[model samples]
Target chain A: MSATEGFLHGLQLAFTPELLLTALIAAFVGTLIGVLPGLGAVAGAAIALPLTFMFDPVVGLVLIAGIYVGAQYGGSTGSILLNIPGDSTAVVATFDGYPMAQKGRAGPALAITAIGAFIASTIGLVFIVYSSGFVASFAITFNAVDYFALTAGGLLILARISGGTLAQGLLPMILGVVIATVGMESTSSYPRYTFGNLDLTLGIHIAVLAVGIYGVSEILYLIEDKRQRASYKKIRIKDLVPSRSEIRQSWGPWGRGSILGFILGTLPMPSATISTFVSYRMEKGIARNKSQFGKGAVQGLAGPEAANNSAAIGSIVPVLVLGLPFSAVLALMISAMIVHGIQPGPLMMEQQPDLFWSVIGALAIANVMLLVLNIPMIGIWVRILQIPRYILIPVIVLVASMGVFSVSNNMVNLYLMLALGAVGYFLRKYNYSLASMLVGFVLGPLIEDNFVRGMRVSQGDPAYFLSSTFAVVIWSVVVLIVIGAAVRTLLKRRAQRRLLDSTAK
Target chain B: MTLEPRTEHEAEPGGENLETPPEEHVEGRRSGSVVFATLSLVLAVGYVWMAFDMPNGTSGDPGPGTWPRVTGIAWVGISVLALIESLKVVRTAPADLFPTGKSLKLVAFFSAATVAYVILLPILGAYIVSSVYMFYVIGLLRSKWDIRGGIYAVVFGVGASLIFIELLQVRLVAFPW
Candidate 1:
């Protein structure tokens, strides 16, 4: 279908009163969970996913997608107002967004983020419509080696951008790959790391770990490092909503961030999180008012916020076409699709156009609804922050532990949760990020199975990995990035030494 | 932290001696990192050997060991990274450990109650286990310290319990007794 037709069709279905109401509710709930420090979009999406099962798959997908979009937008709200970012992507926003709030420009900062996110999301949706077919066609050509290379390239960037040394990022990634190996090996009939325990042989659930890391451990972390018991002051509602100038200024970053975000997000790693950080850095490096960046540049807040929401939209291309989950939330969303006997791949658009179009419609509506709902309600959310940390954290911990344990009604899960929590707690202590580790855990099996399958076909010819044009292209990119990183570090050191020598002379 | 940070437990002269097993420094790194790494290593090694022993994966597929071997390799690789990290921090970084007394007490108290709730679920059914667990955990986290707060904690907890059991309708821990 044409882009205009797709846009009009999605708008027509989504604007219907009942669908709009359902989306608004989802947005509200998603925002609530996403605003909380310990909870994140993945948890918000997963917990809310099963609830949507009772609805028709189309409606269910819409509501679920709504929650997904809302959570991304809502996460920015917390970071912009309070310094505590709800998710990792939200961390970048806090650098300027919260600073703006402290400077009584909370209104403009929140305004840019809310409006920026809405505009970027729209641009991203347009890309998904125009490019999904192309990506799907391209994906049909992906073999194991090509897939492996792409995954590696995405992962390398993820590790490289997570701050600190290459060793720092690689360390967590390796740990994750190992952790994912704990359950059954996907290819071999034999179980790998179950340790003779039947429950564990099934392996640790990715969802549970997400909860423990983002939900449980974070609560524990916040409790330990209580950053001011209350918000500095209430942000005026007008400041939370974008003004005309804020909207006008948003155009440059919004357009650049969204388009760039869409491309970066189609990769296999933490696409949404990475795009946000990179977009923020780009805005700072290029903005005319560079000095205002961390001191509260609305453009800094706007660019990354837009990029992240747009990246969420960009992620759908891979999910819709290749069946490769671009992020963890997509993994669970794919799992949910599996439950409904719907396979996610290139044929899905043709197979289920109505479902496809309606969900897109729902997502577009969800973004608008979040901006509409959240801007006016900053006062209410600020009160939520005042709920007394002593009471709030434990309540969250109680609910999270309860919800997870209830799934199997097994204490084994509880023990696992606690065990994972303690593990999560320690991982944080040593500054090892939990995000990539989880990515490894989930993708390790898939990566291994595919790599081995490719090898056997080549009869142990390692060069077989370089066989296909797609595989070759992907691998070339991976190799270039790795080599580039190494060269960059060497050059940096030389530059530093030269500068030091000149100073001495 | 407020009081001059006393070492929680000094074991042997590892910190004092230059040749302490190196793990002595690392041992203080969160126990989770090591355990996860070990788990990954065992998984990777076992899978590689298993796939190696099997004939060319399953029918028309890569050998059974093929996938497992990669998994095992990744496991070993990642675990080695984590182990190195934990070791580096323990040896090189000045150690900062221990939760505040309040955090520790709450974690310990909640943990014990949860264990009890798990034990009681089969006998008590989903409702009672949830009610009991939620009520106690909420109280401990709050530090509310008043009868009115206690009543509110139980009441709000029950409200949550109702949402889980009635609204969501999933069977939580079914109490046995």
Candidate 2:
């Protein structure tokens, strides 16, 4: 079947009454976490990820993917109305969204952003719908050595480019590889880091570690801060409605931003700061009210919002196709897939078309759901902001701790979560980038084992990477990413210095 | 080609003039971060060293600890660089750092309560061990006063016990001394 036909079929499945209801629930719950500043989609997906173990991996993955997109859209609710960016990505929304709110134009801001997110999301979903099978097919052919080279390339990209200290990034990751080595050598029956404990026979569960490090640490974050008392402001219900002129103005950016966001989000080396900046600049340059930009431009809000959301979609492209996660959050998503016995890569399209298409379709529905729900539930989303953190975190902690505990019924897993929580706390304190470390922890084993095994098979001849033209092409691309990021950073610094000097004169 | 709008504080990112240490009062304390990092570095290096002795690829070939050992060394190397960079006292209160003391104490108190639960689990059974432990942990974190905290603790504890031990079929030691 053609890719378009496949997407249409997936849509038919997604739009069924049962799936529709599920999408709505996912959006509502996702919005709840998204609007609450400290909580995020990653945490939301994870907290709910364990619950999906009993379900079909495709259904489970779709639900989580819906929540993932839904959360990004909902996050703007906090940023626009409350003036607090829900997460780093949503920070740009506040540039114009808050200003719109302050002017009692929050309705238009909400409408436009929701509208923009939905449009951008549709664009991204369409991209995934077409490309997932192609990408998945490519990954199925990766032998151990090819897998190794890709892993090494990915590790370096994740480490150097993952937006934290290269050293700090590798620490937990390298430690994880050592930890993975503990139970037994995967190929041989030899034990390495077990310290001779009988329980060590079974390797550490990456899921439990992710649940603790990413999931539970979030609760710790909430507990450390003063509980957020939901506060309300001048939110005129009328503000939820957008003017015709406003809608017309927002349309262009939504289209442009969707394309921009998709590319940025998909790239291994992100242009996060710039994607928004570029969108903001592009919209402003073309916008009639150019001078109003920085003051309160609606286009400013639409462009960046589109860019970031598209990037989120873009980020998923590589994962569905190649079984490679360019970011930490995606790494966790890959883990979730692994737990369900559904390996993602090229073969998955033929092996599990239902899963691939459902995920893409689910994202599409999530965006539509966001548009449908954003305005009517503005009051509900706003009200949820006031839920006290004191009560919230304990429940969260209880759920996470209990989830980890129940998985293996291992009393040891609960204790492990506690210990990892402390280590995470310290890592945060030092401004060491947890993202790279997380990326490392997730990708460390994949890269190391694959590269080593592949090397061994090649008998130290590095031409193993070149035997297949595909490997050569991928490595070359990875090399380009590394060089580009290096050059970009250097140039960015130079530009900043020159700007500073010019301003000084 | 365009500029990112940055906050003033973010500029002069690495200039020593931005955060000169109070050398007189806090010399050793200031150095603690680096010292701790170095110690971790040593430990990481040790792990890598041990990895070196690990057997390389079998007859068909797959080296035992080659990847972990190499990664460990790389990790150590990265730490050394970060240590030097971090010593400057940039004074930017980086977000996502350690919690304040009171909250930390409460966090520890809950952790200690869990430890107590682990110790008591075999002796007291799943229900009893979890019951008292939950109550104690919540009380330590935030006392709602009176029976509210108690109610929450008991409810959660009971829910946990049934879900974990009864429904999921975890082995719950029922015998207590």
Candidate 3:
């Protein structure tokens, strides 16, 4: 189907009563998860995985997508209200948002955030509609070796970009690949790490691992912290309306941030976080009154908030076109698609145009729904913030456990989830990036499959992997990424040393 | 290129300056890194040893074990480098990272309770096990047992059971009887 035809079909699918209701509920749930401090988009997606299974693949995907968009909207709430970021991407919002709140302009900050997010997402959706087909057309030509290069390059880039030392990122990712090898090997049907357990043959479900790592681990961390409850003044509906000048001030930043965010979001990295930070820096750089930055500049809040939502929408492009997930949340979306027997690469556009277009349509619908839901429901979200940790903790744990169990009705998964949760906690405490690990796990099988296939086609010549021009280019990019990371680390260390020396003087 | 956006705050003109890590905290982090590196090295070695038993095909027709073997070897190298790096840093971590004794106790109690709940789930059924687990955990988290906690736990347990078992038709063992 043509792009226009597919999009129309998607719109038709999205408007169905059942799908609309699903999108609405997903938006509310997503926002709620985002408003909560510890529960991020990854955890929200993991918790909702089982419930999605009950719906058709299109509806299920829409639900997941809606939740993601909703979470993006909700993530700013905590940052604005309490200076605590709901997710890493929302961290930028806290720079200006909390200050605005301190100045009794909390309502305007939130109102502007919702408006910026809506506009940015709409802009991003337009880009996806126009650009995805072109990208997929190019991607369809990728051979096994090229695919191997792409996946390997993607993993290396992610590890290099994920915060902290390279080893800290790589070890967890390698561990994820090792975990992927636990079940039967696809080519030879040889079980690599089953260890005589029958259940091991079935392989670990991605949702189970996600729930364990993101959901269960977060719960443990929250329990360990023993943080005091956040107290914020009750916000009324009238308080949500931003001043006319505030809205006018947001326009320029929103346009610039949306464009920058869309461009950056297509890369194989933590696009939302990176885009928001870059947008903040750009806004601050261009602002006439720079002193207002950390003191509640309208541009600072508007730019990053726009970038956050745009980057989120932009991140979906690579997933849709190349069937490669650059982040953990996208990986979960891919997993959902795979579960429904829908292959996600370029061919999906042709074979499952309805599914493809509907997802895009649902995203648009969900973005619209988020605007309608978040503004009026700001008060409810503030109430969610007031929920006692004790109550929220048990509810999260129960939901995580139930979600894992419902995957295949296997008790073994529950045990695995608990075990992984403990491991996740330790790994997190040590500053290892769990997002890298998850992306590794999701992409591991594909890497192995492509590697083995390329080897077979070449009659076992390893050099065949580098024979293709595309493969060579990808490898070069990977090398450049590593070199770049090493240089950055050295510079940071030098800067730290200089600062320390000056302090001593 | 760097996604560590929080670090940008340090460069902000009027941003709150991030404090340098205290000596004790730095030492604690170093020690923690060393322990983690050691554990990772051990695990990597174990994985490599296991990979030895699997059949590795020729370069042209690599078998199922080839990927795992390569991954294991890479892991071993990374872990060794990490261990060396950790050893070079001179610092000592805290005896325990947990903030207070009570926080540690909460984690331990909750962990043990969860394990027990999972074990008893099949035998006692979802409703009973879930209700008891929720109540106990709620009280543990609040650091007090209360009637309201009990009531919420029961309601949650029953509500969850109904939704998953009856409404969704999930094949969970709902009742032992």
**All-Cα superposition RMSD per candidate:** 6.4, 5.2, 3.8
Query: TM-score of model 2 relative to the true fold?
Result: 0.85
Q: What digit string (tens of lDDT, one per residue) describes model 1 on residues A206-247?
A: 556666655666666555553455444667765555667766
The A-chain TM-scores of all the candidates are: 0.84, 0.88, 0.97
Backbone collision tally, model 1: 18
Q: What share of the true interface contacts does each candidate keep?
A: 0.23, 0.25, 0.49
Candidate 2 error regions (>4 Å): A15-22, A134-146, A168-173, A234-238, A269-278, A281-291, A466-505, B1-32, B58-60, B87-144, B148-177
Off by over 4 Å in 3: A491-505, B1-20, B89-97
* Residue range A20-108, candidate 3, lDDT tens digits: 88888888889998999878899999889878888899888888888887898999998899887888888889999988998999999
Most accurate candidate by DockQ: 3
Of the two candidates 1 and 2, the one with more favorable DockQ, higher being better, is 2
lDDT of 3 at A296: 95
**Docking quality category of candidate 3 according to DockQ thresholds:** acceptable
| Ranking according to lDDT, highest score first | 3, 2, 1
DockQ (Cα-based) for each candidate: 0.20, 0.26, 0.38
Worst 10 residues of 1 chain A by lDDT: A159-168
